[model samples]
Target: MSRYPDVYKSWQSNPEAFWAEAAKAVDWFKPADRVFDASQGAYGRWFAGATCNAAHNCLDRHVAAGRGQQPAIIYDSPVTGTKRALTYAELLDEVEIFAAGLASLGVSKGDRVVIYMPMVPEVAIAMLATARLGAIHSVVFGGFAANELAVRLNDAKPKVIVSASCGVEPKAIIKYKPLLDSAIAMAAHKPEHCIILQRPMERAALIDGRDLDWSALVDDMRAQGAKAACVPVAATDPLYILYTSGSTGQPKGVVRDTGGYMVALMWTMKNLYGVEPGEVFWSASDVGWVVGHSYIIYGPLLHGNTTIIYEGKPVGTPDAGAFWRVLSEYKVASFFTAPTALRAIKKEDPTGSLISNYDLSHLRTLFLAGERADPDTVTWAEHALGIPVIDHWWQTETGWAITGNPIGLGALPVKPGSSTVPMPGYDIHILSDEGHPVPQRTLGNIVVKLPLPPGCLPALWNADERFGPSYTDEFPGFYKTADAGFRNEDGYLFIMGRTDDIINVAGHRLSTGAMEEVLASHKDVAECAVIGAADALKGELPMGFVVLKAGVTREHADIEREIVALVRERIGPVAAFKTVRVVARLPKTRSGKVLRGTMKKIADGIEYQVPPTIDDPAILAEIETVLSNRPVVG
Candidate 1:
């Protein structure tokens, strides 16, 4: 039986009333008069008449409920061998002091502040403090290059910038202040003030007049008896601007509103994660990304749950047992991570010995996102952990998960490669290139009906002109997702890959995900990525990059031949899978998304610029060397 069987009907009957009731879940100072306002075309407004503060709902309200001594954030950094937990009272004190410090620096409401800090407790503190003052925050990934940081600074034109001295890695230390200085020099618009969080591991040169010490400012504010108070603002006010890579090489800032984001994420905590107040919830992601902002900081905190802020890699900090240790130590009830992290652990410890060594009895459910979860990886995790491996799908534009099993509401049957049915507020459809519905099981564009849900991005920051053409212009009254997939008979949505990832061979479109799925099912293959290489006759031929399991010593040629035959037997000769190259590792971004486009460029002998988001830039050079040594096939 469907737990939320009547959800669609209730939403359809009166969306405004439904969302109005949902909005009451948060601590709003003034109730909303208008539920939704769409008079400004596709740029709609939610809770337009309401006034509230996000930080108040996330911190102060819980403290007022007599939960002041309860744990709010648990900081675990294996790289630095440091662990600390802050209760709600302690967090409020820190946030208030920081908020006062920002006020002393002349940071007022509506001012933009760029946060360039590592994944520590301070990142969350800075974000909440910025929100407390009604200022907008833009967090640049700590791993981003100076040029990338400059681009965001110039675009957002922040009045203040917050950063750490350095970031700690397992092998080396990343000096961040140098990068911040270089970025400030390169940017056209520079901030008036810069605050540096001094890390004990390494130090960088600080500017005299423009820079401020984090501890000095906070202590001064505390001594002066400065109080942090939430400044109420209209619900339609912009909360944060998160930049996402654009096809045109410019990062588009996705602007999320405060009212809608708060309501949506709070609902997600109970409905999607199946977590309640005081439960330990951990989302293994950085604070720089949307997943981190929504799940790690806002969602769990808003629901009064204790959120874990981890500062280390999945396998390297100590071993493959690092994640298990944290889960057991924290007694986490719900856990979320990316599939790429799981694949890395599987490659290192194939027998699941590391997972078996820990006591994970407290773990209730496991969720996967950020990338498509392969069936092999999902099945392995479900069998080894003995929990439901739920794979949900969403984008940076949407602040929360859009499709999943909805474990809190009676988890639906798991389909190996599918993201399952859409949530209540979403009306999803698979459309043809001509903007018409496609038949079931036929690949096409994924789109959502117009008037997107509350949590969806209202518009791009200062790019209102580009918003419509980028999202809705492709299909009238619909938001184009740019992903290619189809719906199954059971109403499950299967995302093959991005629309541009479709390989056209001999006038036929073949999904790389389909071929990769077959390759992953093989016993010898640990992980794989498929890309279309240039071919003179076929236009484009499928090329496979396979990462073999540990301790596999079979000849490369024999394994390649077996993979080719498997594709031919399963997907037929139309696939034209010409070459299979075994490689040590694949290039991935800091968020664990495979750089298939870069791989394709290398395979075709085409010169391409290395993306700044890549985790290890040297991996591309290794891939090029492997491609050059491989024998060509026609």
Candidate 2:
């Protein structure tokens, strides 16, 4: 007796009518005549012949509906010791002023505006303002290097750049101005105007003519009584271009459409997250990432839910209790975060004592994304938090959760290692390398049948040619996810790492995720990652790097032996899981995905390019040090 079984059946029967009904949730200037048009092949147009303003629907409509006094955004920064809440009415005023300010700077419709700022309230304001003017925004991660920033700027060719003077981290004050100046100096296409948000802690130098202070422009607009009206754009208009790391050196800009994106995210708020209007929601992710873009800014506001902008690390910001503290203080109903954050907390506090201190009665559900949540971590969290730990699977390109545990519809039976059934509007199938359907329980490539659900990436910015080839060329009319996984008889999808992550040991393909899950189940292992290292005899051998529990002072040799035995017993001897090295930390991206490719290269003694998006470059050197002392396994 699921509450949404009928809804799912109806959507499957007639997807066009179903999505058309869902699109009505948002305020559209002109309603769409057709729900989906796939005549252009894999690059389909959704909500054709419709007009809408994304920013207006997210802000103004909520105010007009008499929810103006409801909390819209709650900015919580533990590092800066700052907390502020803005209601829908106040948020609209700020957005209007900023939108007007951007217009005054000659930023109009269709212009690209690059935002290189931290996780502050102004970051969301700048994005809303950019959308309000029908300009496309590209937000680069604040922690990205100047060279990385320059590459994005050169690609987007933005007319104006909005950035902050400094970002406050727990241990250091990151002066963003120098980075911005360096990037601007390096880029061939320089922006005409730069708007800088000055933080009082550490101010950076600003060139008088080129740089405009945020307060000066906004205050001037307020004094002059200028109001910026939201501009209506075509349904297929680009809302934002997010650059995701490509296998090659260059990053791919994933373009999201305004009309479809708004409609899809609104549906997700009610269905996936089970969040209602005026409820508090917190997504502990940076605005640079897609999770922050959909959940932190657009999705919640589109549904009139209060979203929390958190600016602090998971473990180091005071203690491991930061997440629990935020939940208790804000009375957050749904909490979304990455598994890496939970692993970090588990490493520091094995007994969950830090979490026990906070009362999280208001926390309705905890959603895990970004990377695969290890079963051990999932079990630990569920036992400790006393709430449903939903592990949903999605990508930056998908915009929202594709396959998730539909707790909002009905709490499905918990499957420890699986990201449950595909939501309505998505037709997911497991296909072999030859693009044929694979049997249940057999590992294969995961693909979505075209046309992809609304809110999916329409095309890569300036790389329309690459979009189809990258996603759909392998399987005609199907979007190859590049992820390796299998769906069970019950339709529960279990993602078993990436297709490239499969290791051929003695001609047998083995999943690194399967091996890592086995190793992580060890009581002493706090976190672990497995990568296939090149072997002369077996083609490739499984190598594991593990981080032990904080208080566990067990000898490395003993722990490694136990983990090797555990893997052997669980995955059998075919896995060749012999080498296990205990490391202090794993090389990971800011989003918490392990650099498995980098680890494989380091272990195989092959030259590798260091990814610029890595959270800590020093961790690579640490892994190299660990590998140098350990002899290669045969």
Candidate 3:
């Protein structure tokens, strides 16, 4: 028997009591006056009237608990051939020193500091330091285009900008200082000071009055024995602001609160991830993403678990075995990554040969998120790793998993295409366009009930008015997930795809995700994407694009024919899945999400702006070329 039922039922019976019980694990300077006050903020506030410091909870508490010597961060950068680890005491020392450096630069409580740096230990230090001072930090992805960075700069209006001289990529060294300089020049809200970490790989020329050297400032503070004490802040205070990726103009900055976020992370570390203190947990994501914000930096540290800061790819950065090597060397207990990463590795090493090269004895569960994890990839991973391949569902707004298979409560049965049951706080519903409940196993809009659990975005940064319009107004009394899916009779969630990806063909709604799943099941197909292309008669039609596995020398035409037949047989002919194109690769975001919307626009001949988050702008041109010269097969 699983304990999940009782745990979930306990939450459903008394949500506030459930959360209040979880809050006891965290060391608070002052307890909450009320566990929850429904009349507080946009929806409601958790731990109202509480006082806490996030940095102290993540560092000082653990250090004071005698885990000071335990490794807090394991930084492994295959790209740089660099590997290092920092203990809790050492990490806290660095954060305090850096906090003093920021304090000297006039950064204090409520002030916003924008961090634009690569996946280095200093980035984590900067975030913790900002939190230590009761200030908010916004981390922009390193090496972002100048214009995109400028947009974030203008919106965030940071007082102090922390960045690096450059970021090293597999193929090239990206000079970040120049891009940072251009962004600063373009933005109307000029920051008072810019602190740049000059890497030996590429040194940057700093502006005399405006720029400061990161090492010099930290060294000066350390030499003087200067350390900033943690500043107590209200539980409702914003801890950080993370802007949604790929936003073009006037980005939506998601604000995460201090007390609620801390409590939630502590709970998730134990319950959702089944991770205990002093264990190694790796979330193979960048600091710029939500996964990094929660898992990589705060979650594991808050729970006293050693977190991995990996600066490498799933395939490159040496070879396809990079991830396995890190897992084996670090003895990672739980591993979390995006599905696209697994697909990339599976593409390069189709037989899972590279995975066998490393000893992943300590590896327990493999968690997949970011985008929908197709059944094919999930099955392949499960068979390859001999562990539960859990696919959870969430977004940047939620800041944590909405639905997941909790490893801590009790391991649940593996479901290939389902994102298990909803977590304790989330009350999921599959609703029709008219806002009525839909039947089980029927694809519909997915939404969560009001007063979303703690750790979710309280509101958009300085734009509380826009929050409702963007998220809530569409579905009254519910937070519109915008993704279409359905719940099975057994309560498992099957997220088909984004709501827009559901195409209307001859008066029938068909799922592109379902079609993609079918296409991916083909033996030769390594990965695939399905988009609803415009059709004059049917209104819309499903078009498939697939990338073949390595060493597959079969004819593209033959593989394409098989893919169409598979979809036709599985989903019936009403899917209208006719066009099949074999491409060198599918265009993806830096975070590895397929750019399906952009692909749809290109397929329909609509003008589209290149998304700032695209990994390679040249891939779009190649996709366009492939679409123009359509393969006359399927």
Question: Which 10 successive residues of model 2 have the least lDDT summed?
Answer: 35-44
lDDT of 1 by residue, 1-634 (tens): 7575576578778888888888889888998878898884355788888999999999999999998999999999999999999999999999999999998889889999999999999999999999999999999988579999999999999999999999988999999998999999999998999999998888667799999989889989999999779999778888899999542388899998999999989878887788889999999999889999999999999999999999998898899889999999999999999999999888888878888788999999889998888899999899889998999999999888778877777778999899888876788988988998999999999998978888889989998888888899989988888888989998899988888899899899899989999999888888999999988888999999999988999999899999999999999999988689889999998999999998998988888988888899999998998888756645
lDDT for model 1, please.
0.90
State the RMSD for candidate 1: 1.2
lDDT comparing candidate 3 with the true structure: 0.92
Q: In candidate 3, list every pair of residues with a backbone clash.
A: none
List lDDT for all candidates, in order. Answer: 0.90, 0.91, 0.92
Best by lDDT: 3
Each prediction's TM-score versus the true structure: 0.98, 0.99, 0.99
Cα lDDT tens digits, model 2, 410-483, are: 87887988988888888898898888998999999999988888899988999888887789899997888899
TM-score of 1: 0.98
Tell me the alpha-carbon RMSD of every candidate.
1.2, 1.1, 1.3
Instruction: State the displacement of the C-alpha of residue 330, model 2, in Å, after optimal TM-score superposition.
Output: 0.6
Compared with the true structure, what per-residue lDDT tens digits does model 3 show for residues 1-634? 5688999999999999999999998889999999998998789999999999999999999999999999999999988999999999999999999999999999999999999999999999999999999999999999988998898888889999999999989988999999999999899999999999999999999999999999999999999999999999999999999988753567789999999999888998999899899999999999998999999999999999999998889988788888899999999999999999999999998888988889999999999999899999999998899999999999999989999999998888978999999998999888999999999999899999988999998889878889888888878889999999988889999999999899999999988888888988999889999998887778888899999998999999988888888888998988877789999999998999999999999998899999999999999999999999754332
